[model samples]
Structures are given as structure tokens and as C-alpha cells.
Target chain A: MRYWLTSAFIFLLVTAFSQEPPSTGFLRHLMDREYYKEVVYLLEQTDYDDASLARKDSINYIKGWSLYSMKALQRSAGVLKSVSRESPYYLPAHFFAAYNHAHLGQYGTAGQTLDSLRLENSNMASLRAFENAGIALLQRDYKAFEDRFNQADTSYYPIKKASDKMLDFARDLESHRKKSPVVAGAMSAIVPGAGKIYAGQTGEGISAFLTAGGLGFVTWENYHKNGWKDVKTLLFGAVFAAFYGGNIYGTVVSVEITENEFQKAYDNKILFNLHIPLRNVFN
Target chain B: MFLTKVSGQPEALHRADSLFKEGAFFEASIAYERTVYLQPESKVVHRARYKKAVAYRHLHRYEDALRELDRLPLFSIADTLKSRILYETAFNHLLLDKPEEALWNFRRLEKTREEPLHSSMIPLKILILNHNRKWEEAKGTLLSLVDSMPLRPHKKQSWKDSIKSLYDEDSLPKNYSEEKAKNLSRFIPGAGHIYTGYPWEGAASFLLNGAAIGFGIHQLWYKYYFTAYITGFGIFYKSYFGGMKRAAHLAEIARHNEMKKFNDKCSAMMMRILK
Candidate 1:
């Protein structure tokens, strides 16, 4: 009787250990239904140390996807990277990790991740080429973008169409006139607001010109009427000098701000184009 | 058997309720939403919907909460549940600064309900009236509320006295007059600003007008009449009249700010009484 009872007890333990936990099933259901917040909450409360290896991978993938959905890019990348290569989810995990890095502008890391995939399929290779071109566009290396884009197989219509569009964008960017802050500053120093006009800010240029001209006229009038010995003449001269200097400095700063804004807008456009093909193919 | 039958629904609702109790409102809202999706036709769906709206309100997503409330079929619900929904809807409107809508709903509740909610509506109505700056209506409501109270003679007298004091505070005299300020500055440049309680500005205005006139006279004495007339005298005349206009503008601003403070204080006192 003792032997039979001990065997039954061991069998029950084995059955319990082999079967998936109820919570894991529930978490999967939640994730499938897009109940992301609840999935995250459940994951926080769960102790995964003793969970089976398969279950652990599933949990990490779900958590990573949840964070990604919520736009927590860095956290999503870290969690997705924790899934081992041996797991069945390894490919998707790596793909999302690279996507997250790309979204964060970590182009080099993202490129390395795609390279590690060693893509055997032409579709994936085309996708990588598109992403590489996107990276080059973000870096403002139009030549490199063209080179990478031309290497992709045109049989994939999406890649062909996207590359055509990007090539045109790159051509435009290559011919675009880039402003230099140093040049802007020098021009403004020579003639107030001239640099702003060069940077295509005609209104700001005219305003600066009017202000400095008004101050200069006031200084000249005060000195001509009251002589240099008068306090009014000296005060007006001082005001003119301060305003002239500020105008030069403001022109330089405005040029730099405009350049930065231009680059940011262009980068976002490139990133958005790169994102579309991936969603079309994968999502 | 029962647990297995309603497995996901019960667990989700329980977790949502637990989170709600812990004041994790955003998470609770999500959890409640899951329960609604899991069992849309369940008897507890109305309760879940109500709790979700409450959670959104606590999260300060007032518009979303109102949308949730609007989705509920209040006509089919129990009378007490319907009343609770109406109360929540009115309270949300009050928070959203739609005082007229809140007052209408509160009055509806008063007409339909008995005792507690009816009594509670009186204070809320008074509070809303005050918030809308209808001080006369608020005072009348307060007086009626006081008269309807079952308090002892002394307590009733105290309430009436408090209401009277509130009325007196609201009716206090104006602190600044634009006409008076303009007249003062017209006679003596900058005296109006001083009368409106800006001493430094008054001094500055006085010195500026004094300096311009002094410079004008000096230039004229030096036989530079053209420069004196065009620059010094022009500045003096403009500054003198500008000072008067500025003083009148300042007085008007001061009076506006004083009235705003008075309104804010009355609102605070009304809020305290309601609380």
C-alpha cells in the first residue's frame, strides 16, 4: 500500500510540472486580445524564476511587445533581447529589437542586428536594404543611400516603389543649399540682418535692419546735435553697439536652429517611409 | 463548476476591484475594460461600466468618463442605480465648469428623490450658483436652506447670521475709482497712480514730467526754441497726458483684480460649507 501511494504521488507531481500554468494561459489570452496593460500588470505580479523555459520566453516576448505597443522603445528592446536564440520566438524578438533601435536613431546597432540575422530569404534581404537606405538618409549620406537602395531586388514591388521615391528624395536633398552658422554670423557682423536674409528669413532680416538702423540714426543725431561730450550721445552710442552685437549673435543662432529643424524634419520623413514597408510585410 | 464557468470574468473583475481599492486608477480602468470585453452581456457589466467611469474620473479624464456614462442604458437600471448615475453625471459636469447643466441635473434629482439626495442638492445648487457668479440666487438659496433646516433655535440663528455676513462681504465698497484717479493725475501728474497704491510709479512719472519741462525751459532760455519746441516740449506735453490715462487704466485694473479676489473668497467659503 505504501509503494502504490508513493508512485501515485510522484505521478501527480510530474503532471503538475509538465502542464502550462493557468496564469500563463491567461496572459497569452490577454496579449492576443490586445489587453496590454493587464498583461503588463500580470507579468509584474508573476514570479517567473520557476517557470518552464518555454513559458519564460513567451512571457518576455509578450512583455516586450506590450512595451513596444505602449511606445516604451528602450525598455521594449531590452526585454525582447532577453529571449534566447534557441526559443521559437527568436526571429521576431530580434526583428522587433532592431526596429526599436532604428526608431531610437541607433542606426549602427540596428544595422548590426539586421546583419546578424544573415537573411536567407530575398524578401528579408530587401527589407534590410530598405532599412539600410533609411539609415543612410538619416545620416544625410545620400550617396550611400542610393548605393544601398540600388542593390535591392526590384521583383519585390514594395521595395522597388519605396526605393524610387527615396532616390528622388535623396536627389533633392543632395542639391539642397545647406546654411553655415559661421557664414551667417560674418554676414550679419558686416551688415545687420543680412545673414538672416541669406538664411531665407526676410521678415526677421528686415526687422533687425530697421532696429539697428533706428538706433544708429539716434546715435548719429544725438552726437551731431549735442556733441560727443553729451551723456545722451554716449548713451545712444552704447545702445547702438549692444543692439548691433545682439543682431549678429541672433542671426548665427537662428541659422543653427533652422538647420537643426530641417535635419530633424527630414530624418522623421525617412524614418516614416522605412516604417511603412516593414508594417506592410510583417504586421 | 461555477468558478470554471465564469473564470476570466470573475478574475478580471476581482483584480480590477482590488486595483481600484488600492487607488491604482489607470491600471484599474484597464482591468475593468478587460472584464467588459470578456463578458459584455454579463449582469455585472453595468457595474463594471460604472466603476470604469469612476476610475476615469479619478484619473481626471472627465470627457472619457462622460462618454462611458452616456453609453449606459440608465432607463433599464434600478432606480437607485439610475440616481447614482445621474449624480455622477452632474458632478462631472460641475468639475468640467458646465455649471448650468450641473444645476439642471441637480434640480431634476431634487424633484425625483427623497430626503438625503434632495437635501444634498440644495448645497450643490448653491455652490453652482456661486460658481456662476449669481450671488443673489446663491444668497436666496442659502436663506431657503437655512429656513428649511431642523436645527435648534440658536443653530438656526447662527446659520442666518453667517449667511448675512457672507452677503455683507460680497457687497463691500469698491477700493479704486477710475474717474477719481484720472482727475487726481490731471491736477498733479502721477498723483493718481499714488492714489491707486503705486508709489514708485508715481515718483517716476513725477520726475519724468518734471525733467522734460525743466529741459524744455532750459533749451528755450538758451535760445534753441526749435529744438525745445520739437523735442523737450513735445515730450513734456505727451508725458503729462499719458500719465493721466495710465493712472486711469491702472485704477480700472486694480478694481477688476479686487473684484476677482472677492469672488474667489466667496467660492472658497461656499466650497467649505459644501464639504
Candidate 2:
């Protein structure tokens, strides 16, 4: 292991193992440099069937973590869960794998992973309860949220702020009102931009009102001056008709889009609350 | 110590070479990267960097290839590799849609006192210039390339004559003026589309504008001033301005496409003569 002879030894080892993949030393170097994508690629090329148990744990942990960084949640969960129980990486891997499943909306699988994890340290039990509570919030099971959250230590540093956000979200969800697209369309039909305002687009609704009402006024002016057969009267009348029809259709669509947007924003917050605690505890 | 360093370095590099020969570019790039990282000051480090770039190119990671090539010690690199490194850099830039950067490196290679280097770069230069709308330069380069061909005088003269004819006034791509096209469409709707080689589109645009204007004038004659102004004139104004913008865009596209087509023909003729 002398400094000068390290290169010679590495040379001999590489020559003797020419058929093998790149060394774990090189892979660890890639990890240190944050070359997660290359690490994933190298791990894929490597065959560790005859390799030591320690090396297997190292390779799987690296691959699992890299895939997690890439947001390949399903594969990350699978890889991380495969980190053997005896390996030091097993506990963090189990927690991340469970979170990945919950993020992917497989709450049953996520709960199962958590259920299977055997906590060695007392702090891990609190972390597990907090994670379960997060999954409950994400799944919109308020009763389960109450039960799981009460068991979790809200004062735990990693879950502290996230715990407060969870309470606010619970209150918001209880008060959340769902808008009806049919009502929005009917409202728009009665008043140019009324439906859009109902759907949460006040500015768009006001713009629609001015544009449609302006066209209506122009059509009336042309009709009053030149009669129905006047080209200007007919053109303005036709344009106004199209605008009125399109406005009603657009209001209904906008209401539906707004509803989806609100739902997505809420879900992202839940996912964030879940993510911050895990990253805090592990990283 | 020297023997140990020599054995260690080439062993890693040889693994990369083996992967490259097997067409396992993804693996080769990793191996070459290992060589570069572990042997940063070695003479063969530049070779490792170059090989890594080549592997990246094979993987269709042109940006990554360019990054690896950029790490080479430009001043101390062998003259032969320096020329090739320039070529590879230009090739990657071209693949990345950076024709200006590609042309800069190709021009540098043109300065090398290497005949084959010029011969290799000339065709690529013409192709790139043609696409970039440097028609005159592409023609001149093609003609120079023809003059340098080792062919019978009669055969070479015939090939050069064909190339010249291809770039002649009537045969050359029409350098459509986008400003002129837009102005034409301003004064006469659809005229720009015709100039840019789409007569049907021009006719449709003209009809739409004509209908809107005719309606406005008819309303005006009937004393419906507000209708004439708000409905008919408003529609006409929007369409007219929109047509002018469209005509300008079409003119630019027509100029690019026609130039590209003409260049391809010139390239084909040069290839035949060179063959």
C-alpha cells in the first residue's frame, strides 16, 4: 500500500481483471464528482454475480441513490429495497424506497415497505411514524393522518416545519371547495366574463367582457345605421356570435383547468413536505 | 517508478481502446475518462481525452464530445493530433447546430501546411457555407476544389463547366429579399408568397384581404361609418399587417431551402469528379 507502488499494483490488478468492469474506486470518484448519470451507466455494465456481499451493497446503494436523484422513482424504489438487511445502507434505502412508492401513488406498496423495515435505533421509529403520516396526508385519508401524526414526534428537527405545513394543509383540504364546470359555462352565457371570474381568472374574464361587449356595441351601431343587410352589420354580427359562443365554451374549459391546477399544486406541497423530512434525515 | 507509471497508464488506456473497437462507446468513454483522471500530466493524457471525445461522438453526445476535446493542451499537443483535434471539434460543432464555431475551426485547419487537410476540409466548408447562405463563397470553394482535382484537363474542365453552370444566374438559387417580399405583400396582398414560391397561398391571402376591404368600402358608401371603421377596416388592418410578416418569413425560408438544394447538387458534381 506504499504511495509509489499503488500505481503498479493497480496496473497489475487491472491487467489481471481486464474482462471486469471499471473499479469501485473509480465509481466512488464519479459519485464524489456528482456524476450520477455515469455512475448509473457503469453500474448497469458491471456484473457483480461473483463479487463480495459488501461490493453488491455498494453498487446497489450507488445505483439506487443515483436513480433517486434522477427522479426515476419506481426504479429507485426497486433498487433501494434490494440493499440487503445486513448492509449499512439498508435503513436509509428502506425509507427512501417507501417514500418513492408513496410519491408514485402506490400507498399500499409504500406502507408495506415501511411495515417491513426493522428499526435498529429509537429515533428511526419517530422518522417512520412521520413518513407514514406524510403518506396519509398525500393519500387524503384525514383519519389515518390524525392517527399516524399523533404517534410521530412533531418536535423532531427534520419533520418540524413540515409538520406545521401538514396541519395547514389539513385545514385547507377540509375547507376546499370544488368548482363546477357546468355552472361556470352557464354563468358565462348570462354575462360575458362571469364564468371565468367564477373559475379564478378575473383578468381574463374582464378582458373577455370588454372585447365581447365592444363587438356587441359595434354590431348594434352597424345594424341601427345600415339595417340587417348591410355588409358591416352582417360581418360584425357574425363575429360577435362566434365570440359569444367561444366565450361560454372557454369558461367551462378554464374552470376544469383551474380545478386540476389547484389539485396539482396541493399534491406537490404534500410531496414536498414528505421529501424535506427524508432528505433532512438522510442527507 | 517510471516503469510503474508507464504500465499503469497504458493498461487503463488499452481497456478504453478495446471497448472502442468493440463499439461499446458508452463503456469506452468511461474507461478513457478514468485514464484522463488518473494520468492528467502524462503525454498520453491528450490521446485519452481525444479518444474519450470520439467515444462520446459515437454515443451521439456531441456536446460532451466537444467538452472532452476542449480539455486538450493545445500548445503542446502533437501537430498531427492538433489538426485532427481541430477537425473533431469542428465536426461536433456542426452536429450541435453551431455552424459559426465549426467554420472557425475548419478555417484554422485550412492554415495547416497539410494538403490532405485542406482537401478534407474543403468539401465540409462548402456544405456548411451553402446551408448558411454563403452561396458565393460555397461556389468559389467548389470551383477551387475542382481546380485542384487530379483529373485529365478535358475532364476537369468539363466538370468545372458543369459546376459553373449550376451556379449561373438562371440556375442559382434566387436571393429573395425578405424586405421586398414584405413590402410587396403590404402594397398587394399575397404578392410576397408568390415571390417566395407559393402562388396558391398568395392568392388566398389576397382574397381574404380583398374581401375585408371591399366590405369596409361598401359600408362606407352606405354611410355606416362606425361599422366600416370597427368591423371591416379592423379585420383588413390585422390581416394586411399579418400577411406582410408572413411574407417576410417565407422569403427567408425560400432563400435558405433553395440555397441548400443548389449546394447539394454542386456537392454531388464535385464528388463525381473527385471519384
Candidate 3:
């Protein structure tokens, strides 16, 4: 038995030494084929048993790229943050980082990242300008939005179309906000709900104007009676004051809500292709 | 069946072991299977079976490997070997997404050990319980385990530091009272933050509301009517209706969670007190 064990050990030792190491090319092949999720998992579980810089860099690059594909912006940012500036994958990492920041609505950070790459990435200038216009619109800086939109290159079909549509929508929203506030206030001053109608909130304007006017007439009539004197008159006065103030406030809120709703609808239509002509995934 | 007759079987088994060590897993499995059948009672045969299971796991044939593990009980295996099998079995279950079964086996393995349990097992137990969604129970277990861990050598400091973190998570205060905050904030701006023990935030909200109202009045006085109106509108809405709405939502969440926690704690306490 002892002699047999010795012979077997010797034979296995020889066989073990002859075995080749596993190939690293398999992961790259999978990635090139766009089996992205598979590559991501394999990269996540890549052996960190050896604490080498080259190994760490490869792992980090794979993670950053995979997360970019998955559209997990914040997590991708966290993984990509570890990559050094001098690495071969550095430029790609910066591009992804900027894209992620934009998706997160961190416009300033996204712009900053883009600015850093301007010397090398002149091709994205039009894209940057287009996105800048979007950020300006969100900030309610109409002047900045106009400036960015005008300067944006018309050669890029997507950005040009987006900017043109946004320019119209922004102007429409500004006009609506400016007009509704004045029109609704004047209508309320005249008949209450009529102001709501003028502001295009016809139902609310009519209700408010009618309620206030009716209440004002009732209180004036009641105060003229001999039985209910100072206290009842004072109570009616307070009610009148509240309705008067509330009518004004109500008109403003309605206009704001309407404008917001319109803008939200327009944005959804543009950003999510809600009203756009496109071949959808489900379709 | 004779002792001398069995000596020839070890040669084949050893050759299989060599093949396995060399990473030729498929060939090794076949050889090990033949050896085990040839000398079913030998310890060497049982060892070969264990190695076969390892080879299967490495090859990612987890289910097939786990089957061989289930067959090991019929053989007379050592306590240490049994522990390893149970551990590996539980790990396989985890890989298969059978966390509950893995937890059961892990617990069984824990119970079999004597004084001074392995530190690695504690964290593994906590993780398994966490996966099972027994968070509070897991927290309690970790706390007790941290307290009992040996504080001896320099190398053990890393373990101790980890245990300290366990204690911190377990002992964290449950102090988010949404109901109280909402109730307080409903009638007055910034009151919710105060009720929730966020005094600085409460103060800031009050100051902000006051400043907004003040700015609106100043704008109206200066004849910037549009600015004044918008600012005034924001102040009134935020202070009264918006504050009330936020408080009510926070209060509802707090009340529901607190009631659940109270009921669960009382039941658990009653069980302990009565027992």
C-alpha cells in the first residue's frame, strides 16, 4: 500500500506540473460580444487575492465600463473614482463619469468633467452646448438657455432638434407665467372666478369670484341690520379679508401649478419620447 | 475483503488523487469513483470522495458535487471532517439560493462545536441570518458574539475592531418619531424638526420662513410687485399647508413603525419574562 501511494503521488505531481494556466482572453471576448452583464459579474468576482496595481487597474476598468453599460450612474462613479489619471483607460473613464453626472442632474459637475476633456474631446462640444442649454432651462436662466442654444452646432442632428424644440417651449413657458399672473389677478379683482378663467383656470376662477362676491354682499346686508351690531360685523369683516387675500393667492397657485404641469408634460414628451416618433422597444 | 487484498485499491485511489492535484478534474472524478466502489470501507476511499466533491465544485457542477457530500454520512468520518462537510454543504446551499437550509446546517454545525467557537463562524452566521431577513435577531446574536470574542493576541485586534462595529450597529438608537414630529409641525412651522430632536434644522426652517416673508414685504414696499407676490405665496404655502402635509406623512410612518416595534418587543419580552 505504501509503495503504491508513493508511485501515485509521483505520477500526480508530474501531471499537475504539466497543466497550463487558465486564459484571461475569455472575459474580453464576452465583453466584445456585448454579453455585458456576464462580463460585469466575472469582473466583480475577479481574483483580488494578489495585491498588484496592474490587476487592480484591470478590475477597476472592467467595473467602470460594465456599470456604464448597466446605467447605474452613482455606483459607476464610485467604482471609476479609483482609476488613476495616467492609466490607458483614463479618458474613457472621464467620458463615462461626465455622462453619469449629467444623468444624475449634477449639471455643474458634468460640465466641469466635460471642460477638463475639451482639449482632447472637441467632437463633444456641440453635445456639451446642447446639455448646457437644458441645465440653464432647469435653472430658469432664460438668457443663458438662449445663449447656449444659439451657439450649439446645428450639424449634430439630435442636439439641433432638441435645442430648437426646447427654445420654443422655454419661450412659451415664460410668456404663460408672465400673462397668467396678471390676467388671473385682474379677473379676480373684477369678478373672482373670471380672473381664473382669464388665467385659463376657468372652473376655479368662477368658483372663487362667485364665492367672494356672494359672501361680501351677505356680510354687508347682515351688518346693516339693527340686532347684530359690532361683533357680527367684525366677524364678517375678517371673513371678507381672508377671502380677498385667498382669491389672490389661489390665482397665483393655479397659474404656477398649470405652468409647472405644462412644462412637465413637455419635458416628459421630449426626454422620454412620449410624443416623439420613434420605434419603441415593446413595439 | 481481506486486509492484504485492499492494499491494491490504495494505488488506484492515490493515482486518482494525483490526477486531481494536477487539475485534470474529469479524469480524477472517474478514477475516484472506481476506487470508492472497489474499496468502499477504506478511509482513503472516503478522502477520495471528499476530493471528488472539491473537483466538482471547482468545475462549477455544484449540484452534482453536493450529492456526493450527502452520501458521506454512511461512512465513518471524523468530527473535523464532518464539520467541514456541513460547512461546505451550507455554502453550496447558499450558492443555490437556499439560504434557509444553509442557515439550518450552519446552526447545526455551531451547536456541535465546544468552547471557544471559531470567529469566522460568527460573521458567517450573522450574514446568513441577514439574508433570511431576521435582522433584529441577527443583530442581537452579533452583539453577544462580539462580547464573547477572545481578546488575546496582537493579530486578534483586527477581529476585535470588527466586533466593535457589530456592537455599534446592534446598539444604535431607534429614535425617528414621525407622528410626534408631524403633530408638532402641523400647527407651527419648524415644530416638527424640534419634536424630532433636530433643533438646528428647526431653527433654520423658522428663520428661512421669516426671512422669506420679510423679503416679500420689502419687495412689495419697493414696488417689485411680482417678486413680492411670488415670495409671499411661497412663505404662506410652505409654513402652513406644506409643513402640515410633511408632518402628517412623517407622523403616519412613525406611528405605524413604532406600533409594530412595540408589539414585537412586548411579545418577545413576555416570552422571556414568563419562561
Candidate 4:
């Protein structure tokens, strides 16, 4: 009797405050407030097994978008790719899913995602071409980039600037002079910091020059002043020799670092350009 | 009437709270958010939001808790609710290692009428103030709070004395300026190290630099200009710059040690009161 009464009282308390929330607008409202975590959580908890195809698409789109915003790219891609072609969310889903794949370095899959989409929308076709060009650029394949870029209709407003930027990358990469380690090392041996300068590190080259020059002078002075037998002369000579050798080694290492840094910076730009149009067109 | 017409204990607020109690904080956070949407009343919404932030805190997601807490309308909230929000915000900020934000929230909360809550937070506030190196402010706060306590006059005075002693100038950390140490070492190699309490190292540095300079002068006097310029000046150049950097580094370590010792003492003194 006591347990039942207590249960009844609890039921009454629950019913006293009970009100049905409008399901359709509630998720949208949570999304508007940027409560992405909540949006995902709510969707996960609610039973949507019997939801209509269109309804399912909308739910999946929302889930993917929330995951994307939270930077869960792999999960976002998986969820987004599930949105059916019949749904209004198809274009954005496919585009972002491709972007996520590309981001995760699944270049082949990303290209295939774009390639398989046979959109009649002229703008989407251009977007597809632009995205393909970006992928080629990331792979550093200039020829593929040029062919795909020419197919892209640059007149599409959302992708026009990005298209131009992609072309610039093509031009820049074609003329880019990657420094060779052997040439840099040879130059450093001849002129202490010349190799670093050729590696595009002017400041470092000048600093190296001074250090090496100073050490060379020290070695010369020690030999001239103390007949090359005094402890001071020997010590200075040894120190000077080490600095000279280290400078040449450092020049080679610096050239490699500069080249790698340049490649990374350009790749980041290519990725960023690819992302802009997706946001502009989808949003 | 509308709420009562349907079956809702906050549309699962009780369930959310139960989840929180069961240590299912992540799930509780989601459930709290569900309640926020399902429940129409602004008060219920606020309650749910606060509970969600608390759940996030339990999950050690202080940044998320702070984000959720920021959605609450501070000016429009009830005073008690406002006090709790401020208290929770301070706690989250402290947990996130943001002493400044935590201190600001604690000070704002002090303006409320919740005397017991404010009193309870005194030690923590002092701890934060001490962490930030605002020693005088912490000292004043502790002394004032002691004065306001209804303890016997003698006991109160003793407490005040104890608090004052904790903030004594003699007990404070030695403040070493890295810039000053660097500057001193630039003019005289190892002077900064001496100032930072490494006398033997400082002497060694001084000898090395002095010998280099002397060798350069001796070579110059002998009319071996190239030898003096290269061997003597080259050694001096490296030693001089290297000594300056080492001096600044030593000063940083010295200052860190002193501050740690001072903060440790402060923490120990406040431990009993805080507990």
C-alpha cells in the first residue's frame, strides 16, 4: 500500500508539470541556438525507426551538420553520405561528405564521390570541377588540376574567386624552384651562408656567414699569433673548425625545412579554397 | 494548465537528475537539454540549463559547462538562481585553470545577500587571489571577514594576527625580474646569476668572460690585430650573449622557486579554514 501510494504521488507530480514539446521545430531551435551536442543527443535518444524517408533525411542532415560543426569530420561524413538523393539535403550532404573524405586523406574516395554525382544544376557541376581541381592541387599533380579546372565554369559566383586562386596555385607551382640539398651544401662550403640564402632563408644565411667568418678569422689569428702550438691557438682552431662544419650541415637541413614548410602552407591554402565554396553554396 | 494537462515532470527533469545522481553525467546533460526544450516555463528552462552545466562539470568538461552557463540571462534571473549561477561559473573557471575569471566571478557573487555562500567561498577566493599574486587584497579580505565573525574579541584578534602574519612582507616570495637580470649580465657576465643566488656559477662565468676580454686586449697590445679580433673577440662575443641568456633563465628559475614556496605556505595556512 505504501509503495503504491508513493508511486501514485510521484506519477501525479510528473503529470502536474507534463507538456508535449513540438518535435519538428524543437530540433531546429536547438540547432539555431548552436546546441549541437544536445541536438545529437536528442536524436540518438528518440526512436525514429519508422520516420518517413524525407524525415529521416532531415534528421540525418541535422545530425551530420551538428557533427561537422563539432569537428567530428569522419562521423559527419558517414552520417551525411547516408542522406538519400531524393531529399533536398542531397547536394550539401554529398559536397560536405566529399570534403570530409578529402580532409581525412581518402583522396580516391573523395574524387569518386564528386565524380559519381551527375547533377544537372550548372552551378553544382562547376562546384564538382572546382573540388576535383583542389584535390589534384593537394596531390601536387598540376596536369590533373589544369584539366579539371578548365571543365569548371568559372562564371559561378560562389566559386569564381576560388577558381582564380586555384589557377594561381597552378601557375605558382609550375614556376616554384624547390632547393636542392646538394647545391645548398656545396654553396655553404664555398661561402658559409650562401646555401641558406639559396634556400630562401636570407636572415639565417647572413647570421651563419658572420659566425663562420668569425671562426675562420679566429683560426687564422691563433696560427699566426702563437705558431699554431700554443693551447689558445689550438683551442680557437678546433672551435672555429666545428662551427664551419656545423654551418654547412645546418644549411642543408634548413633548405629541407623551408621546402617542406612551403609545401605545407600551399596545401593548407588549397584545402581552405576548396572549403569556402562548399560553405558559400551549401549555406 | 497546459503543462498539467500533459504528463511531464519537466518532460524528464526528474529522470535527468536521477541520471546525474547515477553518475551518468553525459546522459544527464542530454536529458537536461531535453527538459529545457520540452518544458515551456523560463524558470524550468533556466533550471535545466544550470543542471546541464553541472552535469558537464562532473564530466570534467569545464569549457562546455562555461558555454552552457553563458546562455543563462543573468539580469533577468531570480537572485538565488543568479547566486548559484555565479558560484558555479566561478567553480568552472577555477577548474579550467583560469584564476582571473574565477576571481572575477567570486567577487561578483560577493555582492549578493547569500552570506553563508560568500563566507564559505572566502578561503577559495583567498586561494585564487594568492595564486594571482594579489597578496594585499587577499589579506584585506581575510581580515575583514574575520572582523565580521561573531567569535569572541580575543579569538577574532588572534585570527586577524594570523592572517596578517601570512601576508607579512618578510614571508613573501623574492620577486626576480628576468629583464633586470639579463640587463645586468649583458653589462657584466654572471652578475645576474649572482643576483639570483648562484654565486659559484656566477664567479665561473665572470672568470671566463674576463679571461676572453683580457686575451683580446693582450693580443691587441701585441699588435696582432687579426688574432685579437678573431680569437679574443670571438670568444667574448659568444660568452657575453650566452651569459646574458643564462642569467635570465636562472632568474626565472629562482623566481619560480620563491613563488612556489610562498604559495605553498599560503595554502597550508588556509587549509584548515577551507576544510
Best by DockQ: 4
The C-alpha interface RMSD of every prediction is 8.7, 8.2, 19.9, 8.1
Q: Provide a comma-separated list of chain B TM-scores, one per candidate.
A: 0.57, 0.82, 0.47, 0.71
Overall lDDT per candidate, in order of appearance:
0.74, 0.81, 0.60, 0.81
TM-score of 3: 0.37
Best candidate (score: TM-score): 2
Candidate 4's C-alpha runs over 4 A off are A1-30, A33-57, A84-87, A118-123, A227-234, B1-41, B44-75, B88-107, B114-118, B129-170, B175-275
Among the numbered candidates, top lDDT falls to 2
In model 1, the runs with Cα more than 4 Å from the true position are: A1-39, A48-62, A83-93, A118-120, B1-19, B104-123, B143-150, B169-275
Each candidate structure's TM-score, on Cα atoms with residue i matched to residue i, is: 0.75, 0.85, 0.37, 0.76
Give the TM-score (vs. native) of candidate 4. Answer: 0.76
Q: Of models 1 and 2, which has the larger DockQ?
A: 2
Quote the positional error of residue A169 for candidate 3 in Å: 3.9
Worst 10 residues of 3 chain B by lDDT: B266-275
TM-score of model 2 (CA atoms): 0.85
List of clashing residue pairs for candidate 2 = none
Listing every candidate in turn, what is its Cα RMSD in Å to the true structure after a full C-alpha superposition? 8.9, 5.4, 18.5, 8.4
Clashes of each: 0, 0, 9, 2
- Models ranked on TM-score: 2, 4, 1, 3
Which pairs of residues collide in candidate 1? Answer: none
Query: What is candidate 1's lDDT per residue for B1-275, written digit by digit as tens?
Result: 01012366888899889989999998788667667767888867777888889898998988878888888887677666667677777778888978788777766665556655555656666666665667778787887776666777887778778777877754642568889999999888899999888889999999999899888788688765544564578688999999999999999887767656665765575454544
Model 4 chain B: worst 10 consecutive residues (lDDT sum): B1-10
